[model samples]
Target: MAEITLFAAPGSCSRVATIVLEEIGVPFTYELVRFMKGFHKSPAYKAVNPKGKVPALIVDGEALTENVAILSYLAATYPDGRVLPAASTPMAAARIIADLCFCSATLHPLVTRYCMSVKIGGEEGAAAVKAVGAEAMKENAALIDQRLCEGDWWYGDAWSAMDAYLYWVFGRFNGAGYDLSPYPRWQTHAARMEARPAVQRALAHDEAAQATLSAERMQMGPGGAPKAA
Candidate 1:
């Protein structure tokens, strides 16, 4: 078994974990869990994580779930990786954790609600639910854009895991057809993130993995039925 095995779904929040792992330059294995094919819900994957979520990390034969927990673990285990601020006091650490919490608790959920409004609110009310979520997301984005105007990175002069988390959130919103042009600061921040070699590498890997999974699904046909010749 590899020292680390990250079970992830391409294009999901798992990209943040994969990017961090790449940034750390650690030797590990990546197990792709194709969300498109419902692999994440399969019994096999449920054995790894009963919650059926992506971004589960297996470290030292133990399973770690949740992005915040996994990120904290990586930071603690590899201090040199500099995934978070090197806080000298407890309050300082709390501040960093608070930033991460805001992303996970506030930003992520708002975007997800907007993206999955149909599922959350039923077909008849999906549009209204999505509108509410979109409005909330716009407010949150404006706040973040203002904060980003203060500096290049979220914490000013330092790029941390929070940046990765925020980047993922922004990417999700963008894909959902949210208008991001008004947030110039965020646009710049995203550009810088994309320029990172680690981020680029993770994105490339995710693209390849997603493409391969799509091909496999096609070959298997719908509901695992073989395609006509």
Candidate 2:
């Protein structure tokens, strides 16, 4: 068993990586990177991951960053044939990677803009950036909704890492007060995803990480609300 340790933020995009690990049935541990406390930008975390981002996986001491890269590595290394398609199914594996890439490269950027335009875009231009991001996100949501129309999971019968990834992505949008009801298939998919045993386990892991982060004095919002920014 490789000594896998993940440095991740609690409910952030890193939750996708945590779900992938649980879905693969890997014995990995979370290091509890508290973004609210600036631990991700600390010297220690920066040493582990120069980019100072969540979802950094330290596998037997070698570090891998980025959600797509981490998920791909897990799929290839674990060979679970579930969280992601196994290499034996070459085309399926390739498609999963592409889907992960789309989530990482395409969807995530829009999410960043939609959720953090004030930080990335200037105060004066933040609203405009957020508007554009919201529009683009709707387009992508329709695409995902179409994808979900095929079946409960992205690939129909079986669930993949993409399912967990989308849960975090779309869940974030919903958290930001977006109306996801228009995407009926995706809304149904969300319900099914929440009901999964593996996803429940993953949420437990997230709560554990959250407690650890809290103990470390990570800000629990001004009045005990959630804190990612």
Quick one: best TM-score, which candidate?
1
Per-candidate RMSD, Å: 2.7, 4.0
- Please list all clashing residue pairs in model 2, or write none if there are none: none
For 1-229, candidate 2 gives per-residue lDDT tens digits of 8999988777788899888888888788877776776888899989988988888999889999998898888877777546675555778667767888999999998889988889888999899988988999888999999988788998888888889989998888888887788899998898898998878898898888777766656557768885565
* lDDT tens digits, residue span 1-229, model 1: 3499999877788988998998888977889887766888999888888999988999878899889889999999889998998989999999888888898788877876888888888999999988988888878889889999778888888888888998999898888888899999998999999999999988887898888786775686678887642
lDDT, residue 161, candidate 1: 88
**What's the lDDT for all of these models?**
0.86, 0.84
Model 1, residue 141: distance off in Å is 0.8
Cα error, candidate 2, residue 164 (Å): 0.8
How far out, in Å, is residue 177 in model 2? 0.4
Q: Which ranges of candidate 2 are over 4 A from the true structure?
A: 87-93, 212-229
Worst 10 residues of 2 by lDDT: 79-88
